[model samples]
Target chain A: EDKVVQSPLSLVVHEGDTVTLNCSYEVTNFRSLLWYKQEKKAPTFLFMLTSSGIEKKSGRLSSILDKKELFSILNITATQTGDSAVYLCAVGKSNTGKLIFGQGTTLQVKP
Target chain B: DVKVTQSSRYLVKRTGEKVFLECVQDMDHENMFWYRQDPGLGLRLIYFSYDVKMKEKGDIPEGYSVSREKKERFSLILESASTNQTSMYLCASSPTVSEQYFGPGTRLTVT
Candidate 1:
């Protein structure tokens, strides 16, 4: 049974604050991990990590995966009200292209 | 840019009625997926298609059916709409077994 769990189900932060969202997974033949941010209508892709230790970053968002530990973390720096959304983490299977997703972390950035 | 589109953004259906959700991708991706999003359950895979006319059941496929008549279109059908089936349905497509591009999503309400 593949399972993905995320910590800090909800968080409240102020402008310029930094936040870290954690994701842990237990799956067979783990191939990749992905992050997404959902505002209102849809979720936008953030980062995809396959290798352990190496980090992927965008303008103010970054993520890293640790295959050995079976976990991944997404960090958002200089948070703004625009960053308020539900962050989702998902793990993909190598052979089937199937994905198992976590419950997600809801972050509300205050002005 | 990969553009995944859903047939509806919001839909309301009565109990025991049949419902259909359509998805299309312009990128001609090899794989397409259907998932349901809930408040605390995250996104649960309902079904997926690797190619035209080839469908596979995901973690939860009960009471749902899928169709992939064309390479770029995938449809999810509910045999009988129930109140418990009300959710946000997401459609995604991928070129390979990697990062998937998602559609804006359809919010379905069953009364």
Candidate 2:
């Protein structure tokens, strides 16, 4: 069965502290991995990684995938209160382009 | 910009009542998906459509049915609303399976 797991289900950190969120997935015919940040309502796209090793970054957030290890990590630097949200990871299959998502990590940035 | 819109931000329904959730995507994406978000379960796929009138059962399709009469619209139906079905419903769309854009989500409460 295809499954996605995330580590550190919840985290609380100071405003300036950096945090790392992990996601590992097992699925047939891996195509891509995606990251999303959900604040109070909807989720916004963060990053999409298809190749291994190469990193995708936007502002203070960056992510990378390791297909060989069947895992991915999201790194956030210079965190702020606005960055407090639920981070979600989803793995897409090549055969049908369907995705399987993880439980997500809740990060709270304290001032 | 990819804009996925849900019909409501919040809804309340009585137990055993039939419920319908509507979603529309502006982008001419080929894939549309419906998912429910819970506290610890993250987002679980309920149904998806690759094209008009072509529906596929997702990981959690029980007790739910979907309609995709047009390319830009997808609707989820709950034959009988239950307390356990109260959740945040999310709608997403993608050109393919790579990156999905999500709606603001509808918070449904059943009594």
Candidate 3:
């Protein structure tokens, strides 16, 4: 079975602090890795990383995939209270639209 | 923008009752999926359909069934609502092997 694990299940940081959340996975025919942010309702897409070493960024959030290491990391720079949410990492397999998601890292940013 | 819509935001049902959760996507995607989200479980796929009338079991398919009568709509049915089935249900759709668009989840509570 494909599995994705995330590190530091929960983190607390003050505003302007930087946080890095980790996700590692084991799957066959790996395709892409996706990041999402969930506050109260549904999760919103953050970034999608396909190639190793190449980083995908959006404002204060950036993510990179290390295929060789079978892991990915999501970085939030200059965090704000609005960034407090559950950050989820999901892996998609080749030729299938199915996604295996990590347990998610809960980030709490205090002002 | 792609839009995924769920029928309800919150639902409460008695044990043994038959419950149905509806989901619809407006992007005319060929693949639709149903997932349940829990505190520590992230997202567990219940079932998915690649085409109309085509269904496949996912990682956690027990106690859940799905229907894809139309290309744009997928419905998840719980044969008998149980306390263990209480969770936030999410629906997603994708065109191919791309990132999925998710609906605002439906929170179900079984009493």
lDDT (Cα, tens digit) per residue for candidate 1, span A1-111? 789999989999999999999999999989899999999967888989999999999999999999999999999999999999999999988887777899999999999
lDDT of each: 0.94, 0.94, 0.94
Candidate number of the best TM-score: 3
lDDT of 3 at A22: 99
lDDT of 2 at A56: 95
Residue pairs whose backbone atoms clash in candidate 1: none
Clashing pairs in 3: none
State the displacement of the C-alpha of residue B27, model 3, in Å, after optimal TM-score superposition.
0.7
Docking class of predicted structure 1: medium
Best-fitting candidate, measured by DockQ?
Answer: 3
- Per residue, candidate 1 scores C-alpha lDDT tens digits across B1-111 of 889999999999999999999999999799999999999889999999999999999988998999999999999999999999999999999998888889999999999
Runs in model 3 deviating more than 4 A are none
- Of candidate 2 chain A, the 10-residue stretch with the lowest lDDT total is A90-99
Instruction: List, residue by residue over A1-111, the lDDT tens digit for candidate 3.
Output: 789999889999999999999999998999999999999988888888999999898888889999999999999999999999999999999999999999999999999
The predictions' CA RMSDs to the true structure, in order, are 0.9, 0.9, 0.7
